[model samples]
Target chain A: MSATHDATHDEAPIAARVRHVEALLEQRGWLAPGEVDERIDALAAGGSPANGAAIVARAWVDPGFRARLLADANTAIGELGLSMAGGLQEQQLIVVANGPDEHHVVVCTLCSCYPIALLGPSPGWYKSEAYRSRVVREPRAVLREFGLELPASTRITVWDASAESRYMVLPRRPAGTDDLDEGRLAALVTRKGLIGTAAV
Target chain B: MPDRFAAGDRVRTGTVDPPHHTRLPRYARGVCGEVVATAGHHPLADERARGLPSTPRAVYCVRFAAHDLFGEGDHAVVVELFEDYLEPAEREVRR
Candidate 1:
């Protein structure tokens, strides 16, 4: 009898549980009806790598903006109306600049904690256990797998997101694109470049 | 609580493994690193994970040399660590 009951209700247990919780929250007056769906939809709609690319493009064109971004990332992004808000607790944004002699890469060994509002959802590989573990241990080798070959002289700094802060890499502006406008430069930036897995 | 660490201070991560949830990565435990920057105070996640009240503690961006950490690389790794995870280590004269 128990086996039959379990067989009939085992499908989509997680989703069913989520609905149950949402219903409970509504019943308790803690959440409005459809609030969960609305929030999820908002997150999904905001998910895009273009957001990060735009920030990079702006930094490439404006020295003052770049300085501000390096000094304080959350406020700097606000100038463009981008924010890391809307979550339960605000996550801090930390921007690390890539220089001629230095490079930056980010990883979350504990989990796939990233700046979703700024960079959209994280790539699948970034959340994979292999990437989470290997990137911090053998960054150059892992970056080599991504086809990023940095010279021995160029130091690679791996930023591990363990706490509330989220990091984004500001790749050095590529050479020979002097005539490009900010929008064009933004178009030239790639998601991988913003994550420091590849160059712009 | 007042901040116990600042940029440029040498510190060592605690090695004793706790049974509860923690953000301290296993590979980084017992390692010596330098405080590169202060990341601001944050509630101790270990306590919060246990459903206990947690006050904000100082956090730091600690930089560890790849060579020292893994015994063979030339680069470096930086981790955002809570104050409770570190202890002041003797300063080294050379890099």
Candidate 2:
């Protein structure tokens, strides 16, 4: 057998590793289940991706700042005090904005690898296996399933997040809100806004 | 791992040599691009084999132009890929 195979075989099973970590954390009294759950609930209800939307909104209003964000996402996002963590930290976090001819969608074929730090925990359907396997290969079809129908002429970009790179779609700005300030624009940029639908 | 490619390095999405665990999508294979900026690496998600204790692996962020992957036109899609998913192109042309 190859050295890598031999090594992997000798190593502890993944389940065992999970149990080991759990046991260690439990022993150390660091696994505060109740408190963690509460914290998650609060963060979720507060709107996790809202912060990202606010940044996008400000960029839209300020040409110079928008150049900065388009040039460098991390630094620009950091200026707003958001650090990519959870699954986002390891991957490239790119904000794909919707243009007149194109629309972007995000999915993880293997699992729900998301930019949770910026976008919060994924919605229920996003984590489902049904969405994962079917989205990348059949984006237009799956998007139709989501009740989003685009013209046949519109190009579709299905971002298959498999590795460290995570993606968040930026929906187009809504009409009638052209005069809205950054604060109002931010409020409009909802979670669905980051999902490439429902302009804020 | 820190960023491996500089601003001008040419790269391509590595072929999916299956029978191994990978996060690369099937559609991304063989696409080419010039490195825009290097995004830092994070953990490796080899959960199927490594299980829970598998620590994160270093990854680099590389950006590909929309025209290269799709086709030439006024409308193009830009894409960024993590390092593990890329391979050095046969000819390295600095863009």
Candidate 3:
């Protein structure tokens, strides 16, 4: 009898339950009538890696801009008239630079806290417990596994962004691109590069 | 609006195992490190999460040696920590 009753439902149970939640929120004035649609629109347009790429490209071409970015990342990024502000999580963005002998990588051991506003959604591997646990303890081995083998002489510095200030790595510019413009340079910057897993 | 810690200042994370909302990560508790940069003050998200007023607190980027937290390696790890979660560690103080 119960099986027959379940099969007779016109709508899927999950869909019906969601509709019930929507109706209740609207009825209780907890959510304005079209708020759901507005949020969907906002989420769709947020978190693009192109934003971080552009910032990195500009820093590469202009030394002064790089200085400003290193000194105060949030303000320097704001000068571009685009927000580096995390959605619903107002974290301050810190730009870490990679040099000849020094490399920087970012991780949140407790949770996957990252600058989603600029770097876009985190990659699946970055959120894995294996990554969060092992990266800080054995960054060299992890990066090597990720195909970014570094020289023994080079030092790897990991940035654990655990608080209100998020971090992005300003990857050392790759060689043979001296003539490339900002747009071309930005094309080479990948999400992994910004996270310091790989170089640009 | 002044920052409590400046670059090069050595500090230690508080070991307060608060049962409520906190921004400090467990791995960083009581670890001593040098302040690498001053990121100014920001609202405490932990307090805000618990329905309490978020008084702005100074935050700093502190750099810790690999051995300090993980017990091995020559590499370093920098973490962003709030002032309330930190206190001054003993350093070379000249009279």
Candidate 4:
């Protein structure tokens, strides 16, 4: 057989590798059986807050700060004392602003890359293979699949986040939110908004 | 080790061999940016990339202009990455 075929045959499946790691961790006493399930449950219960939402709310209330954030996201985020680590540390934070004639969506063509620091661990739908592959190549169509129908005249700016820079979609503030406080504005920012599927 | 770059310092993303652990995205390769801030060290993702033990290393969040990422007229965007994903931005400085 050719070397390529031999290599392919030797490669282990991802699920098996994960299982092996789990077994090794258990054998070494580093992890207890059923601990994985418990940890998963805990993570689910502790839903991460929407960091980008908080930033957007601040921006909507204060135009000057919004300009600063658009100019430099790191400093703007630092103003809020939020640390950038995990996937965020590996990528830049670009807050895409939605306008009357434009909408932005983000995707990682390679994997489920996301701004967990700002938006939290990716939801199940975001991690789906269908979302990753379809979003970058056919954003408008995919948005439709998510039940978001945009105007044909509206321009779609798709942010393909394939590297260390992550993106957060800044949905236009909802009507009647002009007088809302920062806290209330933040509550309106949802993961869907960050993904550019829903407006806050 | 701490970050090799600092806020306001301009740096360029360097190319590294593939099949290596990297926080640098394929799209950001060769892109230039200003070091906006430094994030603390964390377990390296290289271990998972190389099938070895992940080592801890310093990470930083750098900001790149939108024009730099996409072209002119494009608004700016910022990306945070670890030191391992970066190299000296060609122009070395005395730290």
Candidate 5:
């Protein structure tokens, strides 16, 4: 039980502590030997940004579905048999649309809340204290740091996602992509696009 | 259950600081805003963190102008806050 880790022991302290805790749980019969690894593998595969890309692609092609998605995101998303819920309460998901004159960005001022089911692991900056504090106070400057420089006339809406709901940005469809199929359109969508930090 | 406010109604976030987990961020405390949408009930994350029973409370998307909260900016900020953290923004006595 007191044995040291292998030759490659450069893991971060917090990660090492987590592994140590998991090992203790496994020995105590609390966790099946491989349960932790199995769950992590499943989550990594299941919560990819491609999930959000697929939704965006569908919305770009189908006006009716887009209307429904914007009307009530959780219900509309559930219609596709996809869930956005996590933890104790039903984490309601909201879809905000960006347009020619309007843009939307999401941040969790208090914490790094996000739409993990659709957007996958959030970028480190999105969860940083600098971002969490500055985005709401100085959104344009923050956006500029992300290399997105919107026109002065455009209106930006910064959404502070909280315990009750998560927000996803519906980035505007890029010009000259009208002829592209849904699969091709989806391929062009990036995680940053879904977070309103970049254009598709 | 009836929500404390409806869409278009003016409201303000509360200022009390709970020692436990709270969805209300300090930046939004006491800030005035208007309710744009009503999300259904959910357990209080603050109370749940303390192992106390929390009834479902109505949550709302409150939209505040940048000028109102940050003192400068052209953009707007919308925060999703649960019922307990909100109160009616006292309307001025109309002429």
Candidate 6:
């Protein structure tokens, strides 16, 4: 146990602490030696912003899917062969749609809780204390910082993930893309748009 | 347990300042907000953290005006809160 701690000495404090805990779990027969890495690799492999983008593209083209997504996200995503059931608990996913009059943004004020299985890993800024606090306090100002300036007439809604449910923004499709296919539409959907920091 | 709140109900959050884990963020404590929707039952994260046995409780999406919560922004903040963290607020009959 002590040797494992020393073996991670060259790593950062947080990484070392994580390694120490993993080593302890392995030693106690609670986890296999390489199980943690395998799980992490699997998670990384499973998640991607493209998955979210594809869903958005489908929603853009299919009104029925869009309605289904707005009503129940987990089930709607399952229609696309995607799911929020990555780990033990199947987190409740709420899909908030951004409309001409209202825009939606997501933040985990307590921690960096996110729909990672959908949007891939959260951005560095999303986890920053500055974003966690300021976005909730002054969303328009923060969106301005992200180079997004909503019209004065537009209402902003910030979704704080403080419990079991997670949220994702369904950004309105951009204009002049009517000729584009679903794949092209998906290509236009950026991670920031899905997070509601930018318009897609 | 039955849902204690419904969509469109006015509720006020509890100012619970326990040292243990809680899903209710400090920013939302004691604030009055409207219940916009209900998210079905889930175990209390606080109880789970403390190793106390807990039954799943209904969660609600509570919406507060930015002017009410932060005093300046022209927006709304929606926070998902457990049933225990909220109580029926005195109705605001005065607009």
Model-by-model lDDT, in order? 0.89, 0.65, 0.85, 0.69, 0.85, 0.90
Best by lDDT: 6
The per-model DockQ list reads: 0.81, 0.23, 0.64, 0.11, 0.75, 0.90
Per-prediction TM-score, please? 0.91, 0.65, 0.87, 0.58, 0.90, 0.92
* Least accurate 10 contiguous residues by lDDT in model 2 chain B: B70-79
Candidate 1 Cα deviation (angstroms), residue B79: 0.6
lDDT of 2 by residue, A27-136 (tens): 78998645556776767654377777778787878877777776666667877776664341233567776778778777776678777767777788888888776665
Ten contiguous residues minimizing lDDT sum, candidate 6 chain A: A1-10
Per candidate, the number of residue pairs that clash is 0, 9, 0, 16, 0, 0
Name the lDDT value of residue A136 in candidate 2: 53
lDDT of 6 by residue, B1-95 (tens): 67988998999889779899999998888889999999879889999999999998998999999877766788999999999999999776322
Model 4 regions more than 4 Å off = A1-47, A86-91, B1-95
Residue A48 in candidate 2, Cα distance off native in Å: 1.1
Which residues of candidate 3, in runs, are more than 4 Å off? A1-20, B92-95
Which ranges in model 5 have alpha carbons more than 4 Å from their true place? A1-15, A78-81, A85-90, B92-95
**Candidate 4 lDDT tens digits, A33-64:** 98999877755643255667788888889888
Please provide, for model 2 over B1-95, each residue's C-alpha lDDT reduced to its tens digit, 9 standing for 90 to 100.
44556767777887766665666555556777666555455555545455656544445444444445445332233344656667778684433
Itemize residue pairs with steric clashes in candidate 1: none
The 10 consecutive residues of candidate 5 chain B with the worst lDDT sum are: B86-95
Total clashes, candidate 2? 9
Query: Model 1 lDDT vs. the true structure?
Result: 0.89
Residue by residue across A1-200, what tens digits does model 6's lDDT show?
Answer: 45556653545578677887889999999998889889989888877999989999999999999999999999999998999987676888899999999999999989998988666789999999999999999999999999999999999999999998888899999999999999999999998998899987
**Candidates ranked by DockQ:** 6, 1, 5, 3, 2, 4
By lDDT, is 2 or 5 better? 5
